[model samples]
Target: MDLTNFLKTGTYLKLKVGLSEENIYSCFKKKDLSKKYYYNKLDKNEGFSYFYGDGALEIMVIDSKIYSLQFDPARYPYILTLFNNIIISHKTSFELIIKYLDIADIKWSFYQRYCHSRELTIKTEENIFIGCVYDKGDYKLSKFQVFEDLYNGFF
Candidate 1:
């Protein structure tokens, strides 16, 4: 599956928003890393989902529905290509990232400012939201998210 498209459009291959947990499970193979990753003896939890391998990944679940997808580039070397010539890397600086978006004429904005890290969000042409978190120490890319719902508020 083209993950770039998924990040930009919020649709995983043929899957769409509001799909059941079972649907998500069927779409991707997942390893139960709960014990290894979370140190939880339990097998599974309704509040969490996993796609652990290669790069560290996490999913948020609400009422058995996929809420969002998150990726950690710092865990593994991964490059995400959003458009023809636009790509995101772990070491990509905030200024460089925003420059890429601006060059592509993509709409984006600073979503929030935090003590240790800050967030920037971009609404795709599909109206889906994609967010990135940058480290305060170096202002490098830390992680990014693809949301399943519309969010207009800022904090």
Candidate 2:
């Protein structure tokens, strides 16, 4: 299929990493990832609930209902701090950021619209409509600032 058609059909799928069911199961049983987190099997009549970090986040019930549970990075303040630090430290311009995203295998498209705004159309490999970036103004900045602006507006 053509790229546009393939994207529309959601034919792309992300490959699984080395993490396995058995490994996840063991971690759950032993509470290896975080002692504060725990999981319980749902009953046949009930839907599964994947709780994370003192039950602050739930994976949400779905059709099959079998899901792995663990600590959520968002639940910890340190995670956000670390993320912000990383984003700030990455000294990459908009051009370099786009290039790096391509190298990182992220599916995205870039466009220049008008003088003040640049558009960044993005999608997941699975054709999920991730979002876009519209550079409102202040396009010229240090590499770090450019990257920060893009990432800050990515969502």
Q: Give the winner by lDDT.
A: 1
The Cα error of candidate 2 at residue 35, in Å, is: 12
Task: Point out the worst 10-residue segment of candidate 2 by lDDT.
Answer: 141-150
For model 2, state the Cα shift of residue 16 in Å.
6.6
Q: For candidate 2, what is the TM-score?
A: 0.30
Per-residue error for 84 in candidate 1, Å, reads 6.5
Instruction: Report the number of backbone clashes for model 2.
Output: 0
Q: Model 1, stretches more than 4 Å misplaced?
A: 1-3, 15-17, 30-46, 84-87, 113-137, 148-155
Best of the candidates, TM-score: 1
TM for every model, in the order presented, reads 0.63, 0.30
lDDT of candidate 1 over 4-63, digit per residue (tens):
566455565555656776775576655543322322347445366555545456666666
TM-score (C-alpha) between model 1 and the true structure: 0.63
For model 2, residues 1-155, the per-residue Cα lDDT tens digits are: 01222223332122111223243343354352233222344543343444444442233233333232211222432221111232311122446445544655667543232123343434334322322233454232211101102222222
Alpha carbon lDDT of each predicted model:
0.55, 0.31
